[model samples]
Target: MSYVLGIDIGTYESKGVLVDRNGKLVAQSAVPHKLEIPHRGWAEHDAEATWWHDFKQLSKSLIHMARMNYGISADEIEAVGVSSIAPAVLPIDRDGTPLRKAILYGVDTRAEREIAALNEAIGEERVFEIGGQSLSSQAAGPKMKWIKHHEPEVYEKTYKFLCGSGYLVYKLTGQCVIDRYTAVNYAPLFDIHTLEWNDESVSHMTEADKLPALTWSTDIVGTVTRQAAEQTGLAPGTRVIAGTADAMSEAISIGAIHQGDLMMMYGSSTFFILTTDRIMKTKELWPNVHIVPGANTLTGGTATAGSLTRWFVDQCLGRDMGSGEASNWSVQQAYTYMSEQAGLSPPGSNGLITLPFFSGERTPVHDASAKGMMFGLSLNHTTADMYRSLLEGISFSIRHNLDVMQELGASVKRIVSVGGGVKNELWLQSVSDICQVRQAIPEITVGAAYGNAYICGMALGWHDNLEEIDEWVNIIRHIEPGVNDREVYERHYAIYHRLYERTKDLMKDL
Candidate 1:
C-alpha cells in the first residue's frame, strides 16, 4: 500500500503521522520541544535544536514504526509534506543554516517597536491595501525590520529569511521556498495581487533578495536530499511539497474547505475561524490567501487559548503530564477535576474571570500591552476555581473573536475543532456551550500533519479535490451546546466580555 508522511512542527511539540492512500492513519509519533522566553513578552525557538532536531527525530521514528510495526517500506511513502506554526521569522545563511534563534508567531514581541515604527511610516490604510491587514507584531515585515534595526550585526550576516515550514522544506530539499499563505503574512513585503515580493516595500532594507521564493502550499518544490534522507530515514529523491501554515493545514484536516465552514484550532494558541469568501477589510481580523488556490477569505483569533490552560496546569496545578496520554482520565483529568470542583461554586468562577492574555492577544483587541488578569478575586475562591475561570475566560475570548467576524458580515454557522485542546472533551463542550455554536471533533486529532497528508494525496492525484477530502475526512463525534448550559453560559459570557473592558486600562499600566 502506498503511504504518505505528514510532519508538523507545532509551537509546543513536533508530530508526524503515516497515512495510507485511503486516508487511514497507519502509524504516528511525536516529540515534545520547549519554547524559550529570554525576556517577558518575547518567545523564541532554537530553530536548529528544537525545530529541526524534533523534525528529524519524529520523522525517523514514524518511519521506523511504519517499517517495523506496519511492514511498510520507505519506497511506499509516495510523498512527504510538512506544516508548522505560521509567521515565524528565522534568518539563515546561504546553505540554510539558521543564523540565530527563530521568532515565533503571535507570541514573540521583539518586533513591537518595529510594528509601531512601520505603522507610523506606512499608515494603516496603505498597510491594509498592500499588506491586506493592519500591521501586528505577527507580521514578518516588521520582525525582519526589527532584526535590521536592533541586531544590525546579525542582520548583516543573514543571507535569507524563512518561516518554520520553509525552513523544514529547505532542510529536506536543499531549497528555500515559502508558501503563499506564509509569504502573504510578510506583507507590505509581498504583494497579494501579484503574489511576489514588493520591491518598494523592502527598498529601505538591505539584502531584500534573501527572501525565499514563493509557491503554493501543494506545489512540489524539490526532492529529498541525501542529508535529509539520512536524518529523516526517508528515501532519497522522495517528493517534498511546499507546505502551509498550521491554521490552513488544520482547516484542511477538519474538512473546513467549503465557503462558510470555519475551523477553530485550539492548540498552543487559539485560531478562531476561517471563511472561504472574502469580506470587507477590517482591522480586527486578518484577510489573507487561503490554502486552496482561488479561495480568498478571512482568518483571525486570539493568540492564547490552550496555552492559557497549559500555564494553569504547569504553573498553577504543578502536575507532570505525559505526551500522548489520551485515556479519558489521563487526557482531561486535570480539567475535569477542576471543572467538577468549580461546578460546585457558581457561574463566572464566583465573580472571578481571567483575561488569559499571557502571550498578548490577537483579534478584537490587538493590544500587546494587554496582560493576563484575574478579576474579582476575593478571600472566597480556591485555586481550582481560578483554574476553571481561566478555561471559561479563554472560551469567552474566542466567542468575542467570533462575534467580531460575525459583525464584519462573515457567516459562521458550524465550527470544527482540531488540536491539542480537543483532547479534553470537557473543554470542547465548554467552548461550544459558551460560544453557542455546534462543534464537530474528528476521529483523528493529529492536526496539521494529517492535513498535510491529505494535501499530499490531492497533489499526487489520489483524490480529486478538497471536497473529496471532506468526504474522506471522518468525524468521530459532535458536541452540540446544551440548551440549559447555553443559556447559563450566555449570561456568564456577558460578564466575561465585561471583564476585558474593565481590566483593559489596568493591563495597559502593567
Candidate 2:
C-alpha cells in the first residue's frame, strides 16, 4: 500500500511517522534532544546538532521500521511533510550551513530589546493594524533584527533566516521556503492581509534578501535532495510539501478547520486555542495567520503546561527520589506518580494555588519577569499537593485565556486535547473540570506528526479536503467535567484568578 511520511521537529524532540492511505500507522520513531538555555531568557538549539540530527535519525529510523517491521518499501512512500515549533530564527549561510545556533520559539526572550525597538519604529498600533499581531520576543522579525544589531559578524554572513521546519525543508529540498503561518510570525515583516513579505519591513534589515521564499503549507516546494534521501532512507525525487507550525498542524489533525473550532495542544508548553473567525484585536492575546488558506484569524495561549510537571520532578524531586539518572523513573513515571498524587488531593489542591510561570508567562499576562508561586503553602503540604496545585494552576491559566478569547468574541464550544499531557488522565480531567469544556481525545496522540500526514494525504490527492481528513481521524475517548467537581472548581477558579492579581506586583520585584 502507498504511504506518506510526516515528520515533526518539536521543542524537546523530533518525531517521524509513516502512515498508509487508510490512516493506519505503519511505523513511528522519535529522538529526544536537549534544549539550550545559555541565558536566563535565551533558549538556543544547535540547528545541525539538535534539530537536523534528530530529524535525520528519526526519519531514518521510521523508514527502517517501515521496511523491517511493516513490510513497506521506500518506493511506496509518495510524499513527505514536516512541521515544527513556530517562529524560531535560524540564520543559514549560502550553502545552507547554520551561521549560529537557532533561536527557539516564544520561550526564548533574548530579543526583548529588539521587540521594543521595532514597536517604537513601527508604532505599536500600526504593527497591530498591519500584522494583526503584537510584537513579542517570539516574533521572528525582532529576533532577526537582534542578530543584525547584536551579532554583526554572524549576521553579515547569513544568507537566509529559517525556522525549524524551514531548515528541515532546506535539508530535504535544497530550497529555503516557509509556510504562511510560520512566516506571518515575522510580522511587520510579513503582510498578513496579502500573505507576503512586506517590502518596507525588509528595508529595515541589513540583509533583507536573506529571508526564505514564502508558500502555503500544502504547496509542493521541491523534490527530495539525493543527500537528504540517503540520510533519511527515502527514495530519490520524493515530493516534499511546505508544512506549517506545529500548533496549526495539530489543529488540522483534530478537525479544527472551520471557524469556532478550538485546538488545545498540551505539550511542553501549552498552546490554548486557535480559531478561524476573526475577533476584535486585544493586547492580551495573539492574532496570527491560520494554517488554512484564507483563514485570517488565529489565537493562542502559552505557558508552562506539561513542562511544569517536568520541572517538579527534575528540579524538585528527582535528586531526592533517586530518579535523577537519565533512565530511572522516566517522565512518564513521574507524571503517573504525580497524577496519582493529584487524585489523593482534593480539587484546588486544598486551597494551595500555583502560578506556573516557571519559564516566564505568555498570553494574557505576557510578563517575562513572571515567576512561579505557590500561594497558601503550609508545612502540612507534601510534594504531591504542590504538584497537583501546579497542574491545576496551569489549567486555571488556560481558563484565563479562554475567558479572554470569549471576551474577544471567539466562541469555544469544545476543546480537543492533543499531546503528551493527555496521557495523564487525572490532569486531563482536571483541565476539563477547570475549563468546563468537553474534551475529545484522539485515538492517536502523535499530534502535529499526524497532522502533517493529513496534509500530505491532501497534497497527494488521497483526500479531497480538510473535512475528509477530519473524518479519517478517529476519536477514541472523551472526557466531560463531573458535576460535583465543576462546582468545586468554579469556587477554586475564583481564587485562582485572584492569585495572579495578588502576586503580579511581587513577581515584578523578582
Candidate 3:
C-alpha cells in the first residue's frame, strides 16, 4: 500500500505524521526543543542543530513506527511534505552550511533599526505598492539587511538565504526553493505583482540571486538524496514538494480554502489567515498569494497567545520550568488547574485587563518595543482573577485584529480553529465570547503536519483538486459566543485599548 509522510517544525516542538493514501493516519511522533533567546529582542535557532536534527529524529521515528505497526517499508512512502515556522532568515554558505543561527519570525524584533532604515530609503508607500504590505518586524527582508550590516563577514560568504522550510528542503533534496505564500514575508525583496524575487528596493541587503527560487506550495521540487535517505530511513527517490509556512499548512488542514474562510491557529502565537478572492492590500494586514492557485489571503497575527499563558503558569504559579518542578503536579496538570481556576472567575475578571505584548505586539499595533501590562490590579484580585484576565486579554487582541480586518472591508464567514491551543477550552470560549463569532473545531486537528501530507497527496496525483479536502476534514464541535457578558466585555475592551494608547510611550521609555 502507498503512503505519504509529513512533518512540521514548530516554535517549541516538532511533529511528524505518516498517513495512508486515503488520509488514514497510521503513525505519528513529536519531539520538543528549546527556543534560544540570547538577547531581549532577539530569538534564534541553530538551523543545523535544532531544525535539521529534529527533522532527522522525527522522520526516523515516524518511519520506524509505520514500518513496525502498518507493515509499510521505506520505499512504500511515495512522497514527503514539510512546513516550518517561517519567514525566518537563515544564511548558508556555498555548500549549504549554516553561517549563524536563524533569525525567527515576527517575534524576533532585532531588525527594528533595519526596518526603519529601509522605510526611510524606500518610502513606506512605495514598499506597500511593490510588496503589498508595509515594512514591519515580520518582514524577512529587513532581517536580511540586518545581517548584512551587523554580520558583514557572514553576509559576504552567504550563497543563499532560505526560510525554515527551504533549509529542510535543501537538506533532503539538495534544492533550495521556497513557496510563494512563504516568500511574501520577504517583502520589498519579493514582488507580489510579478510573483518573483525583486531586489530593486533591497539591493543594499542582497541580490535576488542570493534568494531561493519560488514555487507553488504543492509543486514537486526534487527527490530525497541518498545521504538524506540514509539519515532519515527514507527511499532515496521519495518526492519532496515546495512546502509553505506552518500557519498556511495549518489553515489548509481544516479545509479553509474558500473566500471569507478564516483559520485561527493558536500556537506559540495566534495567527489568522483569511482567504479572499482578491488581494486585500492594507498596511495593517499582510496580503499574500494563497496556497491555492488564483486565490489570496490577508494575514495577521498576535505576538503572544500560548506563550503568554505558558509564561503565566511558569512565573506566577510557582512552577519552576527549568527544574520541571510544579509542586506535585505535572505541567499538564498545572495547566488544567489554571484553566479550571480561570473558568471560576467571572467574564470581566472583576475589572482587570491585561495587554499580551510580552514579546512586543504584531499586526495592527506593529510595536516591537511594546510591553506587557496588567491593569486594575488591587488586593481584592486573586490568582484566578489574574489568570482569567490574561485569557481575556488574549481574546481582546484577537478581537482587535478582527475589527481591523472588518474595517478594511473583509468579511469573516467561517472561523476554523486549530493548533495546540484548541485544547484550552477556557481560552477558546473567551475568544468566541469576546469576538462574538462562532468557531468550528475539526475532527483531526493534527495541524500543519496533516496539511503537509495532503499537499504531498496532491503532488503525487493522489488527490484531484483542492476541494477534495472536504472528504478528509469534518467539523466536530462548535463554540458560539455568549451574550450575557457582552456589556461587561465591551466596557473592559474599551479600557484595554485606552490603557495601551495612554501608556505606550511609557512602555517604550522604560
**Most accurate candidate by lDDT:** 3
C-alpha positional error of residue 422 in candidate 2 after TM-score superposition, expressed in Å: 0.5
List model 2 lDDT by residue over 47-133, tens digit each.
888878887888788888887886888888999999988789999988889999998877887777777888888789988877777
- Assess every candidate by TM-score: 0.94, 0.95, 0.98
lDDT (tens digit, per residue) of candidate 1 on 1-510: 899999899888888899999888888888887778899988899988988898889888888888898788888898999999988999998767788899888777667778877777877687777767787767788888888998888888888898999999999998889998878778668776777787767764546677888888888899999988988899999999999988888888888887788899988888855665664477888888776577776878687876777667655455444222433235356666655675666555666777788877887788777788787789988886787788888888888888888887788767888998886766777777787789988887788999999989987888877888776577888998766756667777787668778877887787
Look at candidate 3 and give me any clashing residue pairs. none
User: On residues 1-510, what C-alpha lDDT tens digit does candidate 3 reach at each position?
Assistant: 799999999998899999888889999888778788899988899998999999999999998898788778999999999999978999999999999999999999999999888888888898899999998888899999999999999999999999999999999999989999999888878888988877678585787778899899999999999999999899999999999999999998999877899999999899999998788899888998987578899999988898888878887667555224647667677788889988888989988999999999999899999999999999999889999998999999999999999999999999999999899999999999999999999999999999999999998898888778888999999999999999999999999999999999998899
Per-model tally of clashing residue pairs: 0, 0, 0
Q: RMSD in Å for candidate 2, one decimal?
A: 2.0
What stretches of model 1 exceed 4 Å from their correct place? 319-345, 485-488
Worst ten in a row by lDDT for model 2: 318-327
Off by over 4 Å in 2: 319-324, 486-488
TM-score of 2: 0.95
- Model 1 TM-score on a 0 to 1 scale: 0.94
